[model samples]
Target: MTRTSLRGVIAAIVTPATPGLDPDAPRFLRHARQLLAEGADGLNVLGTTGEATSFSLDQRRGLMEAAAAGLPRDRLMVGTGAAATRDAVELTRHAGDCGFAGALVLPPFYYKGVGTEGILRYFDAIAEGSAASGIPLYLYNFPALSGVPYTEDLVSALVARFGGRIAGLKDSSGDIGYARRIAALPGGLDVFPSSEAVLDQARAGGPFAGCISATVNVSARHAAAALHGGDDAALQRATAIRALFDGKPLVPWLKQAVAARMGDPGYGPVLPPFVPPDPAAVATLVTELEKIDKAPARP
Candidate 1:
């Protein structure tokens, strides 16, 4: 059956933690609200950028419930994948119960060399477990970090088997060609390339639904203008700002930027196994961002 999927600029926001390093619900809600106020069509909380895996399942769920309570649930999707099948199922069900628009699920990454069939079975459980709630699942393909790429064939197979339950995908593979091909797949899947660089193409009638991007946290205003209004200058500025993060530690650098923008160091704490970004690097990013922000919009 055909179904409408989430489209437009969705920001994968950074999670703010308290000094004790727990997911700060009030701070998280504030950031989520801020993103929507700044022109983000939706928010993808607890994704890789939001440090989902770094937080405990309870922490993730508490934050999810808090977000759903405070924000428009239809405008929020949360990362629900885990290396463990049961945990993935639990989180996916919780997300559905919380009334989220969708769950962005990564492949079971702890296992290497698990072929498509193995991964398929893993998702089969997730699909069945959350079937009662009917929450859609957006396959997250971030091979570099997850090391478990969702091949096109696998995606097609899942869609065939699960239909609307397999709503769409977030292709962080950074391969626009692959994302385009996935968007071309049957069953009305909403394929979101993980960068605002493609906003112009999408507005040009490209197949992509829109973008699910970490950098959109800072670039949402420009992205929304570009995607919804066909503003090329806005698109360029958004992409230029996004490019500034290249080669830096993505999560920390983004947190640093958010902390600076909000003037609250509480946004500065990243979960362990990750540390704060270098001050010099953050300064350089801020400087370049200022230049892009000040550049005149093309007439």
Candidate 2:
């Protein structure tokens, strides 16, 4: 089987919420369409940016279904990773049933001390069960959150074992060295650096197929332009804009930034266990993001 190539800028889109925190279908569709219109090559729905862990299983299904309905299947990648293997398998099947191009599966993270052999087994199980589902599976390596890093050796073994079934990886560890190391692996596996800064190197012939960026929620146009044009100036601008939200707690800061852009006053509520950013922080983020928005595009 031929390797699946996922190139270009894919946006890790945010999930829109109504006053009571229910999934705002209309707003979610609007966001997806806006990202696609703004030059995003594909949509990564229900990702970290979309607060997938905060949502229940049914809610996740709803979001993926809505995204699949609103966007072209060829341009949509849905996160089907869950703490539970059964849930991951079920959700992945659902994503395929809904016509998503692929499912990004996080390793079984709830169990710590999961060795490389253990991780491989977990992925193998998913691949075996998902044979008929037909959704390509991409490993999600966000060690900071998952507590299970996809080491180079482990990644190689999985690729060799699963071949084309293990489509690619979204390396959100925020380490360029890790990203480059994974990209350097043989077999032409697709490696996606989770930031815009690496786009230049990726474009310069690294093994990276593209980027899956959370910042693209606000800077999709610039990110997409940088990826395709290979413009250093454009990439620098994207890096700077992303730097604004670098330190802020992601969920609240991202929602605040999105709300500020939309002029929505009530977009500050994050689901429980994760509070919204304080008003002062929101004000500061707004200021910072506004500066980025108004900054001149590099010539």
Per-residue lDDT over 169-209 for candidate 1, one digit per residue giving the tens place of the 0 to 100 score: 99999898898899888886888999999887777677888
Q: Name the Cα RMSD for model 1.
A: 1.2
Candidates in order: C-alpha RMSD to true structure: 1.2, 1.8
lDDT of 1 at 35: 84
Residues 123-172, candidate 2: write the lDDT tens digits.
76677667786788888999999998888998899988887777788999
Off by over 4 Å in 2: 1-5
lDDT of candidate model 1 versus the reference: 0.89
Which residues of candidate 1, in runs, are more than 4 Å off? none
lDDT of each: 0.89, 0.81
| TM-scores of all predicted structures | 0.97, 0.94
